[model samples]
Structure formats: structure tokens, C-alpha cells
Target: MGPSRPERARREAVAKVRDQILASLLSGRYRPGEKAPSVRRMAALTGRSRRSVHEAYRQLAAEGLLEVRWGSGTFFAETHPLALAPETSAPPPALPAIPLELRRLAERLELGEAGLARLVAYWAGYARDHVELAVVECNGEQRGLMARELGETLGVRCREIDLAELGPAGARLRRVSAIVTSCCHRDEVAPFAEAAGRPLFTVSMDPGFLPPLLDALARGPLVMIVRDRAYGPVLSRFLETLRLPPEQIARLAVVEPDGLIGALAERDRPGALYVSPLVRDRVGRLDLDGWRELEPRRFVARDEVDHLWAHLAWLRARAQP
Candidate 1:
């Protein structure tokens, strides 16, 4: 007696599903112990019958791609052996350009122009071979523009992420080379900063907090986009106390209404240190900086944000393992 047509089709479908399950597991599509899709969901996605999906899953369990946890649903096996392909010889393409709106917003906010420009130049000089960009945004309009510009300019993958949907230490955050935070909530930014050991680029309308923030970032390279000229003097004084060499100070550029330029020496460097005018004006009196006077020129501003992005890209490319 020959096997029925439906039985033969079911067998073939099971084989196909088994192969897919094995491939997905090997590629880390589903982490160990993570639930495999339900039979109905798998059927819907794969366009196969539910019964066939169930049978395929059973076959995969038998072959060790999955484990059936009795009352629990099926899961990718914890100890499944992964077969990795050989490393590709060819390198990835450059990152894309900034979108018009983001370019405008970043220009408007004056975020990290010097650092980002330095980053791009650095990447071109050093790696020139492999550089990827990941832009994080909560809004779709901005996200789409960034992704498109970056993809077109750099030829690298650009992804958008909704901050509201992201959890602490989410998988998407771990996959990026660097993070560009745009209008993200303060609370959300804090946690991502903690987890993002990589370079972070931020733009802000408020320049008052920048000095101390950059001070804290002295341990790492921090790029701040300053939109207001009023705060430049205060930032200049803060840098003067650091006493960095003229060459090092040159790296700091001001992004003003005009063009990007290095830190100015005209600002007064009083021996006595005081809190920033903005801080002082707001709080009346709070000693954020210690009484000790540090040299000025620590905070440099650039007129363009692209310069900042280039700088950061350079730093990140060089830092790569």
C-alpha cells in the first residue's frame, strides 16, 4: 500500500521545518532556552499546516535542535553546537551621511560637530576598511531619515530603535558600535550610558550643564554640542583650569552661529574658581566645581557638528578590537 499524498506532504514539510529550525538555532536567532514560536505562529509564518509544524518540531527535538520541557513550550537547546562560517575577507563600506532634518536638528542643537567630524576623519585614516553606524531614536521620522542618509552615504547598516520599547541591556543596544542620543529622556539616557561602554554623542540646547558633564567625561572622550554663545566663556574658563597643551586644546572647537573654531584665549582665567554662571544664576550658590582653580581651554567648541561626528568615528574605529 502506497503512502497517502497528505502523509507524503506532511513528511516533506517536517523535513523543511527541521532544516530551518537547525539553521535558526545555529545562527543565534533564538537564544538558548528561549521559546520557539508556537505551532500556530510557526504555521502562519512559514505558511505550513499547524500539524506539520508540530511534527517538524518533534523531529527537531529528536535531532537535538530543540528540547521539549514537558509542561513548558519547546525551546532551542541550551547546548546546541554552533557551526560558524569563516571570516569574510572583504571589509564593510563607510557609514551614511546625516539626514537633512537630523543634520538641521544637530546643526540647530550644535551637537558634537568637532568630535563627529574628527571621528569620520579618524575612521577614514585608520580603518578605512570597516566602519558601521547605529543611530538610536524614539521618533520614526527622524529614524527613517538617519537610516536612509547613513545607508546611502556610508553603505553600512543603520537601524532605528524606540526608546520606550527598549529594556535595560536589550539585545539591540549590545549590537551597535556607538550610540547617538537624540531627545531621549534623561532617565532613559542614564541607563543606556551605563551599559554603552562605547562612545556616546549627545546634543543639547542647554549649555549650562555641559562643563561639569564634559569634566566627568574626561576619563573618556566626550563631545558636547553647544547651541548658545553665552555659555562659551564659562566653558572656556573651565577648560583653562585643565592646563592641557596648546595642541591638545586645539582639538576643542566651538560650534557657533558662524563656523567651527578652536577655543579662544580671550576669556579671563581668574585664579579663584566658581560655578558656571548658568548654574550660579539658577541655584543662587552651589559649589559644583571644587574651589581649586583649573586652567581654561579644556572645553573647545566646533562650529559644525559633522566635524564632531568625524572625530568620534575616528576614535571608535581606532578603539575597535
Candidate 2:
């Protein structure tokens, strides 16, 4: 027998939720291995019921477009069948002055149209060959991870440097086309970036972590694991902006990598776990079979990356004659 009208309506509702989430995944609104918004939050955001949202998540999970990590909440699958192709994707924004600049430079050098064409090709190749970015972080672990992420995303070489060592690394920094660091460290990294005359970019925390983190704090104790002690306080300060009560904030603990095992061992029940990307592999090695793990770590927002790309393109466009 076929479904009744009401039943069909319910099915359509579920499909709508599924399709919306799927579109976001395909659009890179959420990146691979990135956590999705919580079911409650998603339901509220989409004006759908929790049941519909749950069913939508289930459908995606079954298809492997999303992963349901038991206690870790849901995440976009790292590999999926629906990868977008380059040709089908929209191209990055192009600077309008590129051709004009090329023409002007060619005229200045007394190069004809054919020579201008060659000059354009040469400049394009030079930009591609020399593109390098520096990622500065307060600690070694984060520096490496951020550098790797930026390198992979932008298809450029990345030099990872610690903030503490930035002054001594001026010569190395000068060779990089730009410097990037977390927004929290902008002030700390600015002087060095200015000294080296390299453009500075800042990455913000991914919004995906907020729902899960807030839920965890409301439920029970929560511990955030970090690779460096100094980083913990910076993270705690960011959390304060969430407007959580002092008591609720107290329930949240930030622990260094070495203290994670102990923190987990002593955590209260119904609590959740959050670990930095720098220490995620190590956390995976522990006995977290039944722990409710929440997503931690930050991502370079798409706008931030796009802005950086545009800046680099403009630099290439303004090539000296």
C-alpha cells in the first residue's frame, strides 16, 4: 500500500531537511571532517521538528555523506561520492585591473602584443611557482596543523613558525608572500608581519563548535584539551563571550595534552570531551569508548580564505614593469 497524504507530507518534510543539509555539505559550508550543527540547533535553524532533523541525519549517515560518531556528534564524512569538480565550480574572483596593468607594463617596456602575451604567461607562472605563506602560532603543534591546512587549501608552500620565535625568523618571513595566524594572536603577530612587510591574515574559530560546546556545558562537566598551557587561557577567554554563567564556565575545564587522560578519568558523568586538532590523534589512542566527544579546533572561514586569495591575486596583478 502507498503512503497516505499526511504520511507523504511527513516524508517530504524529512527529504527537505536532508536536501538542505546535503546542499550545505556540497557547497563547502561545512568542510570534510567538520562537525555539523547539533540536531536541536539544526531543527531550530531550519524551522523543522527534531524528529525530522534526526531522520535527515540518519539518511545522510546511511549514505556515508555524513558520519555519526556515537558519542562525538555527527560530522561531514571525510570522503564522499559527491565531490565537486573544478570545472563545475565557480572561479575565484578576478581583479579587474590585471589586463590593464599587463598592457601598461608591456607598453612601458616597449613590448608588442605578442610580447605582452609572453609577459602575462611568465608572470602567471612566476606567481604559481613562488607562492608561499607563513603560519604563525603560539605553539609548535598548532603552527604545524594550521600550516598544513593553509598549504592544502591554497595549494601553496607554508612556513610554520612559533610566535615566540617570530623576531628571529625575520629573514625567513621576508621570503613568504604572507603571514597568517589565529585572530587571537593578531596583535601579537602584527609587529613581526609589519617588520617583514608581509600581509597578515587571521583565522577565526569555526561556528560548528558552539552548539556542541554549549550543550556540553549545560549537561555536565566538560574538558578542553590543548597542546600548550598558554593556549588554554586564550581559549577560556573566547568561551567567556558565550555569556555562560561563572558556575557553568567552572564546569568547563581546559587541560594540557599531558593531563587529558587524567581529566577524562576523573570527569563527571553525562559530560562531554573536546580536544584540539593538534592533539586529536593522541586523544583517539585513549580509552574513550563511551565518552561523549564534542568537536574542537578552528577553521579558516571561507571569506577569510577568499580574501587572502584575492589579495595574492592582486599582488600578482600589480607586477612591476
Candidate 3:
């Protein structure tokens, strides 16, 4: 009745490889007609065998998403394929038109007529007044900041919870209509949201803010002061993806809070110092003043918070009776 261990492992391998490649493309890694990372490079990054990577590439090519050359390399197709694209406007939500047999079964289960109506009313009312967006992140300050921003923009109550506190089997998760997370914590938070049957969305970055930052990075390497948590590692990978060499950019992590300034007392410092905005307030407590904000480029690029608010509003309205 169930798949064997080998079968399940193979399925997971394909899915993981597929998702990583898609994530790279969506993040604007390569230009149009530019070669994608070689199968060997991808294998190294994903920690998979080259044979598996090659198989995944072949599958994508068959799907019309990638083109492979004999000696050149694999590249993305100029046109993107969006299967059954999400419409700007969704169809009005209506209760399912159940067949007679299913309706009979519902009646037998005491879910007929008034009971069904009560269930509908409860979910609709819950969406109306009890919808709370919980942002699960490991960094407390960043979590609080995101909660504040979303609450202000969406006009809905929001809360922040640590990833450790959010489990798949919690009543707290059931109360949430949606889970909001940064791109970095997405994979970590996805399983919990899935178990709770709620949709999880990653907020995008401000595009206007990034070009100038990238311009700054292009000028020269900078030393980045990072927290020991998720933001540090995630930001590091993001910068490396943009082709900033590790040696050129000095990264400070695993240092205690407010200890960064002291740690830099005699160590090598770059021409510029970049700090995650999450720790900006902490850094301000010190006398130091020459640091630039390291924007994580969270990869969801649309800037206006109100746009996500509007989408949430749409989701709310669509849940009506």
C-alpha cells in the first residue's frame, strides 16, 4: 500500500533538485540565454550526486524549461512556463456542489444542512475577526519588526513566534489563517504550515533599496557583522550568489551581542561595514557609526507591503458565505 524506502528516497531527490533549480531561476541568478550552473556545480551545492543532477536536468529539459547542448551547457528556455497560472482575479468561492451520495454520507455523519451551515459560518466568521498572521523566525528582533510592519500594512493583528515554538501539532497553528515567513525560514516553516492546512507566504524585498546596495558591493568588498542565527548564514549565501568572494568579504558571526565592536578592536576590517538591519538597533548602542545595512535580498522582490495586504484582503473576502 505504501512506497518502499528506495522509492520514497528517489521521489524526494527529484523534488529537491527540481525546487533548487527553480529557486535559482526565480531569484534572477542567470541572464536570458546565459548558461545555468553546470550539473557538477549544482550537485556540489545541493550535496547530491552528479548522476542525480544530470537526471533532473534531463527531466526539466523534457518539460521545455531547459535546453541542453552537446558541448556548451544547459540554459533556461527564453520563455517561462507557468502551468495553469494564478489569475489576477480568482473565481468567487462557493460551497462545493456535492453529489447526492456524498450528501447522504454527510447527513449520516451529522454534517448535513444546519450542521454544514454552522461549519461554514464558523470558518467565515473566524476569517473575519480571528485571523492572525504569525511570522515564525529565529531572530526575535527581526521577528518583532516584521510583525510590526505587517500589522501596520495589513490592518490585521499579527504576532511573531520563534521557529522552535511552532510545531506541526499545535493548537496555536490551527488558529492561524496563514503563516508569514522570510525566504530563509521557508523550508523550515513549510511543514508546520502544511500540517495545519494554512498557506505560507514569504514577503518580498524592496527593489529600489537593492540596486544601490548591489552597486555598493560592486565597488568593493565589505565586512559584514552578522547574528549567529538564520539571517547571518542566509545573507552570506545570498551575497556569495551575487559572486562576492568569501575571502574578499570578511564576515563576523558567532560573536556575542555588542561584542562585535570589541572584536573589531584589532582585527582586519573592510573599507565598509555592512550590518543586518535586525541588529542595527543593538549596533547603535555602541559608539560605532560607519555601517551600511545589508539587505538580504529575500528574493520575493515586490516592495509595497500593501500589495500583500491587498492579497490577504482578497483571501478574506473570498472566504465569505
Candidate 3 TM-score, true structure as reference: 0.46
Better of 1 and 2 by TM-score: 2
lDDT of each: 0.46, 0.66, 0.56
Candidate 3 lDDT, 28-56, residue by residue in tens: 45444667788889899888878768877
**How much is the lDDT of residue 22 in candidate 2?**
52
**Model 1: lDDT of residue 320:** 27
Candidate 1 segments exceeding 4 Å error: 1-129, 151-156, 184-187, 203-305, 319-321
lDDT, candidate 2, residue 309?
57
Off by over 4 Å in 2: 1-129, 140-145, 285-290, 295-298, 314-321
Per-model TM values vs. the true structure: 0.28, 0.54, 0.46
Please identify model 3 stretches exceeding 4 Å from their true place. 1-129, 138-142, 184-188, 209-230, 251-257, 266-270, 273-304, 314-321
Task: Mark the 10 consecutive residues where model 3 has the least summed lDDT.
Answer: 81-90
Q: On residues 194-294, what C-alpha lDDT tens digit does candidate 1 reach at each position?
A: 45444455533234434544553343222222333444444455566766444434334333322221322322221123232222333233232322322
By TM-score, is 1 or 3 better? 3
lDDT of 3: 0.56
What is candidate 2's TM-score against the reference?
0.54
For model 2, which pairs clash? none
